[model samples]
Target chain A: MRFSIQQPALLHMLQVVSKAVAVRTPKQVLTGILLEADDNTLTTTAYDLELGIQDTIHSDDTNQLDVSTPGSIVLPARYLSEVIRKLPSDNVSISVNNNYMTSIQCGQVEFHLHGIDAEEFPKLPEFQSDTQIQLQSELLNDFIRSTTFAASNSEVRPILTGTHIQYTDGTLNFTATDGLRLATRSTTFDDADTHNWTAIIPSKSLSELSRLLPDNDTVIDVQLTDSHSLFVIGETYFYTRLIDGTYPDTSRIIPKVQRTEIRVNVKSIASAIDRAALIARDRDNHMVRLEVQGQKMTFSSSSPEIGNVSESVEASQKEGDDFQIAFNAKYVLDALAVFDNTDVLIRFNGSNQPFTIQQVDGDVGLQLISPVLMR
Target chain B: MRFSIQQPALLHMLQVVSKAVAVRTPKQVLTGILLEADDNTLTTTAYDLELGIQDTIHSDDTNQLDVSTPGSIVLPARYLSEVIRKLPSDNVSISVNNNYMTSIQCGQVEFHLHGIDAEEFPKLPEFQSDTQIQLQSELLNDFIRSTTFAASNSEVRPILTGTHIQYTDGTLNFTATDGLRLATRSTTFDDADTHNWTAIIPSKSLSELSRLLPDNDTVIDVQLTDSHSLFVIGETYFYTRLIDGTYPDTSRIIPKVQRTEIRVNVKSIASAIDRAALIARDRDNHMVRLEVQGQKMTFSSSSPEIGNVSESVEASQKEGDDFQIAFNAKYVLDALAVFDNTDVLIRFNGSNQPFTIQQVDGDVGLQLISPVLMR
Candidate 1:
């Protein structure tokens, strides 16, 4: 195989696909990326059994392409990326001999790496699905950002480690929960179909795609099968295996009624909670109490050994009876971070009950965290 | 202690001095910073036996002074710093009650911390030296940056972990070595004092000070005692205990004569070495070979299992015979990072002998590294 490519273009493509490379795999070839150069297009693919990524670069349209032979090989992702990034020249020339010894040259620098036969690398699963959905990249990115963090970090309850995604009646919903907290986001689709599809995607896969999502308003096409899902963005393809269990029904857990509600500036309340957390962090449960009276919300925490701290921020608006509640400070902070707006509406059912926080002006996304019983 | 000070000012002072706080000391009071408020100033001090820092904030000169009572108390450094940084107001009011309970208030925020009795805190050692010298902070910081990296990270040889500093014959010399490599820097002081002094300051202490040193050309006063040294910059005082062991003689290891010399652009060679390091890093020794032939210098490294890589760059000038030598790429990279100039002079004595690297423009700082035997 012989190919000449622009260094930056190749480096960017390699970086986008290398995210799927397995860090520790029993099979050494699983940690490599399959590079195939044919005609005017070069494709890079990486699969780690559970997740896979494929990105293609067109040399003919983008720049110059001189390919004497068309072939494929698998190279270690990390070493290849490093060499490509550190090369001294703008253009890099790569060629492979019959012995699978690849030579990469750029200006005054050259690197020779032993490549595994591409046939030995596992191929990405083909997308064989009739259900197809198209959405804006921005919308997809927001869905991942809002729901993924609440997913369980442990694998004891395998289903809880994934984000439940469902499309029904022209509406798309994504929910993630770890029993302690749940994040749910929904948006209505323009095109309605008779088909109802649901899938539980591991949070790790969504996070990798989120990192590579473009900021521009590009359209992303998603295809789903019974056991696998695929996301196609521009010249890139991302595929991941679905979790094998059913997600728990979380609708009954959300409070049907709220006795008290408070609207406060997100930054003000977040900072108050942060300071109170400094004291609570030394305690066993990292708990902080919040009390609302009139328009002032007081945040406080106390540790027998570290002392106590209290801070109050004025609520923009208040309703119903004044209330007091206790919660893990970190959970509240994580919920607050998703909001890009100035104000957030916080609804409380009662002390020791779960509370819901949502954007002040919108109800598309909401976070619910169960309160800790005060000792 | 009672004082109303600017929050940012107090926070900055605490951060600078808090580095000396012992995180897990046997004596609990050693984990706190002693705060003393007087008629016109608020002083903060932290001593960890080996290192001490004291900083004073003048209220009369910068802001209004309203101290109803003058007292001293010790507050936990990490908690205090975090609270101060997160406070919402610009001015922070601190007051100690009769029971040594400290109240810190800023705007709508208040923190109550249980403080230790200031009497239990250890006092910083006094500097009783009559011979004092003043030097530019820039010069002091440069001396530290050039020599500290060569200091041994292990405590097996205690003296090698400290940077040896000596003032002799109007020249101030700083040297550090870990047996494998040595770095030395010196500058002539204009004031010829008859009193000569030598001390080994712990690299950790110097590194901490280097992080806080100002970039401007400010004069810093230095005072030396039998076992301690004090540095005063404005209202801040930094004290560190001197290492007790004698430094080894490293002058003899630096080659006085060279058989081969090469001058190259620092960036060009450093980048080449960085690329070569990608392959060598997987090897046991992380060794890279440099071969100088005519005006071109080739950098190469190989791993039996991972393959090999080589890159060559043109040298600006060359003298004597061409030679090839192998050394740890990391050590060479560390030595090259200290040069601020575009060009560097690399001198080689023989295949296995130590070589020197110095800035092409100046002779102040020099680095010597011994070659690794080829397999």
Candidate 2:
């Protein structure tokens, strides 16, 4: 198999597919990206069992390939990427001579790499269900930003490490939780399929895929199976395995009725958290206390060795008795930052109860942060 | 003591003085900066025993401070600096109540901190030296860049970590070596103190001083002692201890004879080395080899477990005959980057001998890289 393509075009496809190529995996082939050069197109695919990425690039010239030989070879992603990026020219020639040697040539620079037959790569799964769902790229990405940050990054519990995406009738909901905090985004999908579906995809894979989705009015095609889910946009396809466990019901953690509802400018609240973080960063627990009363709020944090800080701000809220609550400054800052709106309504059930924060007029998403016991 | 200063000015001075505070120094007190507020100047000083930096900011308004309440104290550099950076206003009011507490107030935000007695800070040595040498700030900085990179950072031999500077009459010379590579830079001072002087200053301290030098054409004052050197420029004073042990005689390592002399574009060679670095980064020993044969030169690197690459380039120097030498790519690239000139002349003595490279124009600086044996 032989092919000649623009260096940039091939390099772009390599970077896309190489995301699935793990540096050190149990399976050696998972660490390499499989390249299949055909008559007019070059397909690069890579998988690490949990998540896989496949992309294809079409050349401008039909003469780019001398033969229509459909053969595949697996090459180390990192090294192959380096070779292409350092090339001195726009177009690079790539050829495979049987199973042992794959040569890449550009100007006076040439690289001959030893490669394994593509058959060694894991078999690709077919999306058997035709019940594909579609959503606007921008809205879908917004849903990801609202939920992905709350996902448990530490893989102590594999199921919690995945974000649960559920769709039914005309509604689409995405949720992520790290036990301490839960973030959910829900919206009406005008083009949603009638079929009921739910899948727990690794939050990291969705975060990475969200970056690759098209912008603006472009639509993304999503397909779900019993074992895995797929997201397709243009020439790139991302597949992630579904975690084989039931996601915990998070509805109970969010309060249906808040004892006090305070509306504060998001930027003002975010800045307060940032200032508190300077001291919080030195503490062992890294917690900051937020005490809300009638029409005033106090932000305070203390480190035994470094003294203490307490600042107050005039805030608008439902007239009620005062209550105190403490939460991880890191989480509060992150949740507050997700809103682009001018003001956010922070609702609380009590001092020890989980708190819900949402944009003043936005019921599209909700964030719940559990309070830490500040002695 | 009470004073008010702009936030940005305080932050700027904090960044420079904080550089002398090491994160993991054995003496915990050395991690704090000594702040002395007196009259019209606010002086912030930091010392790590081996090196010291003190910088002062003058406030035009007498309201910032009163000479009647002259005071001195030490506080953690990182926290104070971060607090000032996160303050909500342009100007901050700092007042020391008694000698036990320090308060910084800005807008509605206030930060209180415990301060260490200024008496605990190490005293600055009274530099008593008869020989005084001065040079352009840019020129002194240039000498540092030319030779400091070759200093050994290894703790096995503490003396090798210093760069030796010698001044006699109107000529000043600097040199550093790490057993393998030796670099030297020299320049003439217009009015030197007519006596020979030699001292070895830790390269790390000199590096910090080099970066902090002002970007102006004015000459910097140099005060030298048998054990320490002081660089005073305007309101900033930098002091560094001199290495007591004798520095090695690196002048003997430079080869006087050569079998090959190559004149090549410095940028092209540096780029080639950077590209070769991709493969060498994964290898056990980060080394790349260059083979010169007549008009062509071959650059190659290989890892047994990975792959190998060999590329040839037509050289302007064909008189080198044939020879192969290997060297650490990182070191070579760093030294080459210091040369801003286009054409560089490389001096070679067989394949095993240490070679020296210098700019075609007499640039006063010379870089040497030793060849590593490939086993």
Per-residue error (Å), model 2, residue A297: 0.8
Error of 2 at B325 (Å): 2.6
Displacement of residue A200 (Cα, Å) in model 1 is 1.0
lDDT of 2 by residue, B1-375 (tens): 677777777777788888887578877678888888887788889988888888897775532433346778788887888888888647787777765578877776777877788888998767777766777898888888889888999988989899999886677899988877888988775663357888999999899999888766768888888888999877888989888888877777778877889888787777777777767854445788898888677777876656666677776664655788888888888889888847888888877888888888768588888888767
Worst 10 residues of 2 chain A by lDDT: A59-68
TM-score, second chain, candidate 1: 0.96
Provide fnat values for all models in the order shown.
0.92, 0.62
Candidate 1 is scored at a TM of 0.97
Clashing residue pairs in candidate 1 are: none
TM-score of each model, paired residue for residue: 0.97, 0.95
lDDT of 2 by residue, A1-375 (tens): 677777777788888887788878777778888999776678999898878999987756632433356677898887889888887756677878755578777766667777778888997778978767887888888888889889998879988899999887778899999999999988875653358788898999988888787667687889988898888887888998888899999877788987788888888778877887777754555788888877788888877677667777777665555799888989988888789857888888778899888888766599999999767
Best by DockQ: 1
Tens digit per residue, CA lDDT, model 1, A1-375: 999887878888889998899999889998898999998889999999999999987766454656668989999888898889888547788999767889998887889999999999997888777798988999999899999999999988999999999988888999999999999999887676436789999999999999988976799989998889999999999999999877899999998789888888888888888899999964556799998888889999998888899988889899988888899999999999998757888899878789999998866599999998987
Model 1 misses residue B97 by how many Å?
A: 1.8
